[model samples]
Target chain A: MYAFEYFAPKNLQEATKAFNSFNDSKWLAGGMTLIPSMKLRMNAPSALIDLSSIEQLKGISIKNNILSIGAMTIHADVANSLDVINSLPALASLASGIGDPQVRNRGTIGGSIANNDPAADYPSAILGLKSKIITSKKEIDAGNFFNGFFSTSLDTDELIVKINFQIPESAIYLKFANPVSRYAIVGIFLSKYHDEVRVAVTGAASCVFRVNELEEGLFHDFCSSVVDKTDYGITNLNDDIHANSEYRRYLIKVMIKKAISILQKK
Target chain B: MRISLTINGNPVSEDVDNRTLLADFIRNTLGLTGTHVGCDTSQCGCCVVHLNGEAIKSCTMLAVAANNSEITTIEGLSNSEDLSAMQESFRRNHALQCGYCTPGVIMSAVDLLKNNPKPTEEEVRDALEGNLCRCTGYHNIIKAILDVSKAG
Candidate 1:
C-alpha cells in the first residue's frame, strides 16, 4: 500500500476543507473498498479524508413517506434496521447479502454507490427504486448519478450526504453471487409501484441499468411467463472470470423467473 | 499520524504511518500477534476483530481510520485462567487442526452471538462465511458456535 497522509474530519465543513488542501485526496467513507484497492495498488491517492467521524452522514430514517438513509450508513445497520425492514424489506435483504458479515459491518452505502462497481448491489437499489442521491451540494437523480462502470456524475471532492429511496408498493432483489467475493454476477432488482414497474439489472452490463422492455412488460402483465422477453443482444455486457457474457444474459432470465415467482408468493 | 484507541481494556495512543493497517498496528506495533493476517486482501477472516463492538476486517481498515474506536483482539477475549465461552466451545468441539483461522473464527463467532444469541445451524454457517477454515471443513466450528448459542 502507498504511504499517504490521512485526516479524519469531524464535520462536513471540515471534510471539505481537508479535501481542498490535498491535491489528490480521496474521501474515505467506510474504507472497505478504497483501502483494499490501495493495498492492491489499483488506487494511489496522495491523501485520504476519512469521513467516518462525520456525524451528519450516518443514519436511517423514514420521513415524508421516503426512506432517507445517510450515506455513511453501513450495510449491517441497514440489514438490521427496523425502519428499513418495515419500509423497504427488499433493500434490507440486498444489504444483508453483501460481501460477508465483516464487510457489511464496515462497507457503507455512500461508498458503494460512489464507487459504482458494476457488480455492486446498492446501485441496483438506487436505480430500481428511483432513489435520489443527495450530495453535499445538490440532489441528483439516480439516473443521472451513475455514469457507467466505476464512474459517477459526482464531482471530484463533492461528497454524497444521503440517499432518498422511493418507497415501492412491493419489490424483490435476486442475485447470482460469486461464491468467493459475493459480488453479484447478475443481480436483478424488481420494484412495482401503484402504476409503474421498475426493473434494474446489475453485473450483466457495464452499468446498472433499468430494463425498460422488462419494466414495460411487467407493468402490463406482472408475471413470470413473459419476464424473459429481454433485449440481451446489446453489444456491451459485463463479464469477468466468474461468468461469460452469454451466461450472464441467460442468468438474467433465470433470475427474473425466480424473482417474479418470489414476488407472487409474497 | 497519531492514533489513539482502547484495545483489550487498555488505552494506547501512538504515532503511526498514514497507510498502516489496523491488523499491522495490532500485531506489530502493540505486539498482539493473535490477530492473524492470512490474506491482506480482506478475503480471509483471519484478520477479523471487534471495532466498536462490531466485527470488521482489520486488514481493510487503516489504523488512523480506527481513530478513537474501541478494539478487541483474540488476546482480549480472556486470560489464561479462563477461556471465553466460545473458546471453550471450540475446544469441546475440536474445532481446529491447523488453528490458523481459529482466532478470527472465534472472534467472528463471538460477534455473531453478541448480536444474535441463539443462531440455527444455517445461520451459524452464514455468519462464518467470511472466516475460511481449510481444516475441519467448518463442521466442528459450526457445531461449536451452535452449541454456545444453544447454551445461552
Candidate 2:
C-alpha cells in the first residue's frame, strides 16, 4: 500500500470536513475490501478517513416496525444482534454467511453496500426489503441507490450513515457461494410485505436486480411451486469461469425454490 | 506517523509508515515474530490476531487503523512459563504438522473459545474456516478445539 495521511474523525461533520480537505481520499470502514485493494495497488488514495470512531454510526435499533442498522455495524454484530435476529432472522442468517468468521468481524454493512460488489449479500437484502439508505446528505431509496458494477449513486464525499429496513411479513435469502472467496455465485433474496412480493437476485449480473416476473408470480401464489414453474430470462445474466449465464439462470430458480421452502417451513 | 496502542497489555507508542500493515508492524517493528504471514492477500488466515477483542486478519488491516486500540497476538496467548489452554489442546491433539499455521490457528481458536466456551464440533469447524491448516488436513485442529471446549 502506498503511504497516505490518516484521519480518525469522531463525527460525520468532522469526517466530511477531512474528506473535503483531501484531494483523493477514501473513507475507511472495516477496510475489508479497500485495504486489500490498496495493497494490490488497485487503489491509491491520498488520505484515509477512518469512521470507526464515530459513536452514532455503530448500533442496531428497532423503531416503528423498522430495523435501522448503523452502517459501521460489522457483519458479526449484525449476525449476533438480538434485535436483528428477533425481527429479521433471514437477515441475520445472511450476515452470518458472509465471507468467514474473521472477515465478518471487521466487514461493515456500510462498506459492503457502499462498494456495491456485484457478489455482495447486503445489496440483495436492501433491494428485496425495499430499504432506505440514510447518508450524510440524504436518504436514498435502496432501489435507486445501486447503479452498476461496483458503483452507487453516492457522491465521492457522501458517507452512508444508516440503513432502514422494513420488517417484512416473510423473507429468506439463499445463495450458492464460491468455495474460496465465499462470494455469492448466484444468490436470491425473496421477501413479502402484505400483498406485495419482491425478488432480488445478486451475483448473476453486473448488479443486484429485481425479477419482476418471479415477483409477479409469487404475488399471485406465494409458494415454492410458483418459483419452480417460473422461467428466468438469461439475456443479460453473468457468464464467468465459475458459472455460465444459463447456469446462473438455473441457480436463480433453485435458490428461489430453496428460499420458498424455508419460508414455507416458517 | 506516530501511533500508540496497547499490545499484549503493554502500551507501546512508535512511529511507522502510514501504509504499514499491522502484521508487519507486529512481526518486524515490534519483533513479535509468532504472527505468521502465509498469504498476504487475506485469503489465508495465517496472520489472524485479536484487535479490540475480535479476531481479524492482521495483514488486511493497516497499522494506523489500530491506533489507540487493544491488540493481542500469538505471543500474548502464553508466557515463557506456561502455554495457553488452546495451545496445550493443540499439542495434546497433535493438531500441527509443519506448525506454519499453528499460531494463527491458536489465536483464532482462543478468540472462539472466549466467545463460546463450549462450541460444538460443527461450530468449531465453522469457526476454523478462516484459519486454514493445509498440513494437518484440519481433523486434529478441530479435535483440539473440541477438546479445549470440553475441558472447559
Q: What RMSD does each model have against the real structure? A: 1.2, 1.1
Q: Which stretches of candidate 1 lie over 4 Å from their true place?
A: A229-234
lDDT tens digits, residues A1-266, model 2? 78899999999999999999989999999999999999889999999999999999999999999999999999999999999999999899999999988999999999999999999999999999969999999999988999999999999999999999999998888989998888999988989898789999999999999988889988889887886677746468899999999899888887888888888788
lDDT of 1 by residue, A6-58 (tens): 88888999999999898899998888888888988999998899888888999
Residue A131, model 1, lDDT: 88
TM-scores of all candidate predictions against the true structure? 0.98, 0.98
- Highest DockQ among the candidates is held by which one? 1
Clashing pairs in 1: none
lDDT of every model, 2 decimals: 0.91, 0.92
Residue B120 alpha-carbon offset, candidate 1, angstroms = 0.5
- What lDDT score is found at residue B151 in candidate 2? 86
